[model samples]
Target chain A: MERTPVLRSEWLKIRTLRSLPGALLALFAATVAFSALAGVSEASDPGFDPLFASLSGVIPGQIAAVSFGAMAVSSEFHQGALRLSLAAVPRRGRWFAAKAAVIAAPALLVGLGAALAALLAARAGLGRAAGGLSTGEQVRGVVGCGLYLMLMALFAAGIAALLRSGVATLSLLVPFILVVSFVIGDATGTLADFLPDKAGQLVLRETYDGTLGPWSGLAVTALWTAAALLAGAWRLCRRDA
Target chain B: MTSIDVRDLTKEFGGRRAVDRLTFRVHPGRVTGFLGPNGAGKSTTMRLVLGLDRPTAGSATIGGRPYPALREPLRHVGALLDAQAAHGSRTARDHLRVLAASNRIPDRRVDEVLQETGLASVARRRVRTYSLGMRQRLGIAAALLGDPEVVMLDEPSNGLDPEGIVWIRTLLRRLAGEGRTVLVSSHLMNETASFADHLVVLGRGRLLADTPVRDFIHARVRPRVRIRTTDPVALTSVLARHGHDAQEHADGHWTVDGARLDDIGRVACAAGLPLLELAAEEGTLEQAYFDLTGAETEFTAQHQEA
Candidate 1:
C-alpha cells in the first residue's frame, strides 16, 4: 500500500519490535481480566452500571498502552537508532509528526478493542441488572474511553521523548497516573477535577456532574496531550539528540 | 564535487572546549583517515559535520550546504557514529529498512547493503543476538544503504576481529575506489597506514597535520638502518662525525638514524669497516603517529591531570 514513507517506516519499526506486541497483549489481557473481575464482584450491587464496570479495565490497560507509546520513541534513543533516523530524515519536526501518527493508530485500535471487550463482559456478567444503553450514550462511552486511552498514551510518549529514559519515564508516569491523581483528588476538593485521569473519566458517565460534560472532559484530556506533545516537539527541535 | 567543509567550527561542553576552530576539507575519490587520540575531537568534528551537534561557533557544510538543509540527507552523506548504539531488539534488516524508508530509498537497496556488507545471512536475526563484529557490519550496512556520495565512520573497527577488520579495510578502499569520499576515524595508526590516501591528524582539539598519507609517513618516520660490524665502536664514531646518531644494541648491533641503507654501505666501504650485516629497518606508522601527536594528545594530559 502507498503510504507516507516516514509513517510507514515508523509503523514497521513499532510492529517489528517484540515489546510492542507484548505490551498490547498485556493491555488486552489486563483489561479483559480486570473488567471480568469487576463485573463478577459488582453483580449483586444495587446500582451497578454494566458499561462502567466493563470499561473499568482501562485503569490498568492505560499503563500498558502508555509504556508501549513511550518505548516507541525512547527505545530508538536507547538503541542509538535515532541517529540513523535523523540521518535519513534531517527535518526533525517532520520526523516527530510521522512518529506521532504511527503511534496514535495502534493506540486507538487497541484502546477501542479493550473498551469494547470490557463493556461486553460487564453486560454479560450483570445479567438482569444491565440496563439497555441508548445508542448515543453507548457510542459516546465507547468512543470517549478509546480516545481517552489514546491521549493518555500520547502523554506518556511525550514524557518519554523528553526524558529519553524508559525507567525514568515509567517512574514518573506511574506515580502521576496511579497515585498522585488520587492523592490530589482527596486533598483538593474542586481543583482535582482538572487532573487528566479524573477529567477523562467524566466522559464515561451518563449523568453530568456540576463540572464538565462527556465531550468537554475528553477535550480537556486532549488539551493535556497536545500540551505535552508540543513541549516534546519543542525540546526535540531545539535540543541535540 | 561532493566534499565536507568545516569553517572555523568550535564546540564547547560546559567550560571545556571539545573542538576548537577546526577547519578541513574531505574531497571525493580519496579515503581520508582522521587520526586522533580519545577526546581529541574526532567524533565531535564528525558530529558537527553531520549537524548532530550544534557548533558553538562557525559552520560545517556537506556538499556546500548545512546537513540539515539537505533534502534526503542520507543520499548526500551517510554516517555511522556508534556501532553498538542501535536498539538491541530490532532485527538487522528492520534497522536498515526503517532508515531506508525515511530517505525514500527502496527496500531493495536495504537488501543490497545487507549483502554488500556480508550481513545478509543474519538479516532476519535481532541485533542483540549478533556479536560485536556482526553489529559493526550492520552499522556499516546501514551507512551504505543510501548509496551516498560521502560516507563517514567513526572508530568503525574498534571491536572487530582480525577478519572483520580486514573486511572493513577492503570495503573502505573499494568505496573510495568508486569515487566516493570516505572519512574514517581511528586511533590505531597501523589501521590507516596502507588504507588511507590522505590523513587529517588532530590533537588537543586542534588540527595537527593534514597531508597526503605517503608524505606524513615519510616526514614523521625516520627509517632506521641496522648494521653489525666487528668495529662497532669505530662505526659509531664515524656515524656521529657524519651527523648521524647511532645507538649500540646489547646484541652488538648498531642502529643508526637519519641514514638509508645505501648511505650506510657507502660509509662503511669508505671507512674501511667490514659490516657483517647491513639493512634498512622500516619504522611502523605507530611510531610516526606518536611522534606527531604525542605532545598534544588530550587524553594523556587528562590522565596526568587526574
Candidate 2:
C-alpha cells in the first residue's frame, strides 16, 4: 500500500484508542467547563480584561491537548507496539509522518471546536463586560487560541516521540505550563514571553504589552514546534523499533 | 527460493553481541524451526530480518531485499515477534483491522483470520480481557491477515493449550504445505519435533546445528540395545569378548551400542545366559537436541528441573 493506507491505519489507531480520544474529549470538557466558571466568577481586580477572562479556560484545556499529542506517540512505546507498527510499514519516515499527521489533524479540529465553546460559554457569564470586545479581536482570539492549542499539542507530540515516553513529556510540560510559566515567567520578565506556551498564549488577550506581536509570537511558537518535530523525526529515523 | 535469508548477520548491544555473524536461509515450502535456549538470539535474529533493529554488520533480507526497501513489507512477510505486543484496550477485531489497514488488506480478511484463529466469539472484547491463549490467536490472526507468502513467529506456542497447540501445529504444517515459508522459534523440543521439517538450532548467539530434523536426530542421537539378563556377569563378559562395550549399570541392566538386538541375544545365548529382558532404545529428537547443545547451553536438563 501507498501512504494513504498508512495514514488511514494511523487514523484508526487514534480513533480506536480509548485514552487518546478520551484526552480529546477531556480537552473539550475541561476548556468549556473552566471558561464557564470564569464567566460566572466576579473579577476582583480593576485590570480584568473580558477577552482574556472569556478565554481563560484555555489555560487548563491545553493540558489535554498536550496529553493527546504525547499519548498518541507514547502509546507506541508500550506493549511492543512499535515493533508491530514497523512490521506493517517498514519505512520509518512513512510511519512517523503518518503518525504526526494523525495527531495534528484531530488536535487542530478539536482545538477549534473547543476554542469556540470556551468563548461562547465564557461570554454568557460576562455579558456586559464582554460587550466591548471588537469583532476582529474575537475572531483573532478564537482562531489564535485554536492554533495555539494545536501548536502546543504538536510540540508535545514531537517531544514524546523523541523520548518515546508520554509520562516524561507530560511531567515536564504540565508543570512548566501551570507552575513554572507563572512563577518563573514573572521573574524573567520580557525574556519569558518567548517561551512556547507563554509566547503562543499572547493572542489570547485582546490587548497585549509583550515584546512580540500576536502573529510574530505565534511564529515563534511554530518555530519551536518545528524544531521539536525535526528532532523527533531525526530520532525516529535513527532509532531501532 | 530463499524467502528469508540472513547473511553473516551481526548485532551488538552496548558491548555484548546479541547475534553474532549468523547465516541461514529459510526456503519456501518448508517449516524451519528456529530452536534456541533463552537469550540465544532467536528474537534478535528475527528482529534483524524484519528491520525492527539495525544490524551492526552484514544483512538480513526477505525475498532478496532488505526489509526497509519493500514498499509494503507485510505483503511479502508477516511476523509476530510477541503475542502480547498489542495495546490492551483495543478489541481483537480492531487490532487486526489496524494491521490490515496498514497493509491495504481487505477488511473482510480481518474477519476471515479471526474466524480461522477461532477468535470470532470475542472479536468485540478488549484484548486485555482475553486470556493468554486468546492473545496468541489474535497475534496469529494479524500475521495471516495480509495473506503473505512467509510467516515468522517467535515462541508461538508459549501460551497455547493442548488444543491450541495442536491447532497451531496443524496450521503451520498447512501453511508450509501451501508453499509458504514458515519459520517458527521455540525452545520446546517435542513441540517443534512434531511439525518442524527443518531445524536451525542456536546457542549463545551462534548456530549449533542446521539440517533436516530427521537427519539431525540420526546424526546426533545414539541408539542403543538394552539387555536385561538373569546371569548379567556371564552376559557382560561374553559381550566384551565379542568386541562390544556393554556397560552394566547398578540397576542390573546392560546397555550395548553398535550391535542389533538379535546379535546381543545371540551373544547371550552362546554364553548359556538366560535373558530376562531384551530391547532397543529408540533415539528421540529431544535426546539428540540435548546431546548437540548440552555443552553450549548455560544450564542443562538438571538445571531446568531444579
* Candidate with maximal lDDT: 2
- The residue-by-residue lDDT of candidate 1 on B113-135, one tens digit each, is 99988889889999889888888
**Cα TM-score of candidate 2:** 0.95
lDDT of 1 by residue, A1-241 (tens): 1238878788888888999888888878887788877876745666555566767788898889889878887886765567667767767888888888888888888888887888788767766655666677767778888888889888888877787766888898888888988778656466787887778877876665657778887888888888878888888888776
**Candidate 2 per-residue lDDT over residues B83-185, each given as its tens digit:** 8888999999898889988888888999999999999999999999988999999888888888889999999997889999999999999999999999999
Model 2 TM-score on chain A:
0.96
| Candidate 1 CAPRI assessment class | medium
> What local lDDT score does residue B258 receive in model 2, on the 0 to 100 scale?
62
Top-DockQ candidate index: 2
DockQ values per model: 0.56, 0.79
User: What are the runs in model 1 whose C-alpha is more than 4 Å off?
Assistant: A1-3, A43-50, A186-188, A208-210, B227-240, B246-254, B261-279, B301-306
Candidate 1, residue B162: the lDDT equals: 88
